[model samples]
Target: MNEFELIQNIFKASVMANTQGRKDILLGIGDDCAQVQVPQGQSLVFSMDTLVEGRHFPFDADPVDIGYRAVATCVSDLAAMGAKPAFFTLGLTIPKSDPQWLAGLAQGMAELAEPIGLTLLGGDTTKGPLTLTLQVHGYVEVRQTPLRSNAKVGDDVYVTGLLGDAAAAVPIVTGEVLVSNERLDYFYDRYWRPTPRLIVGMALKRVVNAMMDISDGLAQDIQHILKASNVGARLEADRVPISAELRQWQPESALSLALTGGDDYELCFTASKEQASEIQLITQTLSLPCTKVGEVASEGFSIEGYDGDISGWQHF
Candidate 1:
């Protein structure tokens, strides 16, 4: 199909699916740009992420997984700010019009959006190297938005859920791992479909002094918080959680991956020692697992139980 036809068929349909029940959406697809209404007394939070084939995923990766990951990555940003997802726009660039590929991609994105209450408002389509960009917007109560700069010395650093599974799954997705079907499925799912800690973020609002999602590995993400808060940390390497799947493969490597491999969309935040009981109670009520991995300090960042300097994923 030609570019215009592809837009009318696949792009339009996806937009329609995304904008359904979105009362705040004033304008959607088939327009120069989409429009939305921002309610008063609420602050709008926006984040965008782009995924390119080969660079972000395998060249022959499943489109559905690609779509889901693209949206989840952006939603994670909202979660970090303790905001409720409102709507999103998708920009897709592809070399050709492939109906099957587009359908899978739309389905993947819709699956995540349906449960998260995210509406796809609008986006643009073009011919180029295959890439998917999602811009998500959320809202938080006035003056209640979580920031990474609020952490104070003596605050307890906490993380939710297991880490490093996504990074471990990367090799499985790229055919680097030779394992049983069960193990392969475990890793592949972790890498492709990550659960953003939206509920945790929302519940921690006002309680957490600083927060961010662990996308670029825990070590690196923690540094972001430390720098913003103008404080250092002493992370207990033994306190980092590693999944059973990862442990089975290489017990020693699990900690390294969990700390430095990246791609885990878990929530990491700082709360005062006085707030620890309250945070624990909240996690129990929500049925989410959380662990105190470190303590905020007035000095430099360092991790216990590991030799030399701390290491994590680097974009460069």
Candidate 2:
């Protein structure tokens, strides 16, 4: 099918599903450009992510997972900044015009976008080696914008939800190792469909002094905050929040995955000591496990009881 027909048949549902009563989006998909209105006194936040086939995912992975992950990863950035998800545009590079694949991809995008109140703002489709690039937009109150460079010395560092599940799924996805169906399913879901902590991020806007998502492993990602904030940290090995699934399935690699595994997508944030109680309340309210893994200090980054590779994922 042609591009126009493909969009009409498959992408229309993604565009129209969230159309009712959406005043923020003045125009979406099929228009020359998407028009949006940033709420009064709120700043617009936007982020983009591109996933390449062989480099980012297994060569023959599910198209539906690709579609969902493309959106989720980009939205993860907005969540870090405590912004409410808005709309997104997609840039697709495909090797062929496969109708079934396109339909599944569109379905994947709609399912994730609809519940989050995200809209399709139209984008470009090109012929290439099967890549997906998504640009997501969000809105946040000016006074509450979370930044990576605001960690105060002595602030407690925290992470939302379990870590390392996605990284643990790499071997399974690439067929490097074998595991039970239940374990495979759990890690695979974490790998392909990461939950963006937008709710906790929004709630953290008033609490956290510094914040970021753990896409490139907690170890390496934490350094970004330390450098930006001009502070160091002492991560407690015992305190890192890890998934039971990871420990149960791969006991030996569990800690490594939790410490340095990329693609966790969980929030890594720092907040003042006085705000600890409030932070606990926020996580409890959202029912997400928030753990204090470290404390911000004047200089130096090190983890107690661990002297291994802490660098997270890097393309090179």
Q: lDDT of each prediction vs. the true structure? A: 0.86, 0.88
Instruction: Write down the RMSD of all candidates, one decimal each.
Output: 1.6, 1.3
Per residue, candidate 2 scores C-alpha lDDT tens digits across 72-189 of: 8889999999999888888988898888888888888877888888887778888889888898999998989889999999999999999889999998888898988888888889
lDDT (10s digit) by residue, model 1, range 1-316: 7666766676456535657666777887667887888777788999988888888788888889998888888899999999999988888898887889888888888888878888777777788999888899998988998899988999999999999899888878998768889998888899899998899899998799999999888888999889988899999999988887899987877888898888889999999999998999989998999999999999798889966335676555
| Clashing residue pairs for model 1 | 217-262
Best by TM-score: 2
TM-score of each: 0.96, 0.97
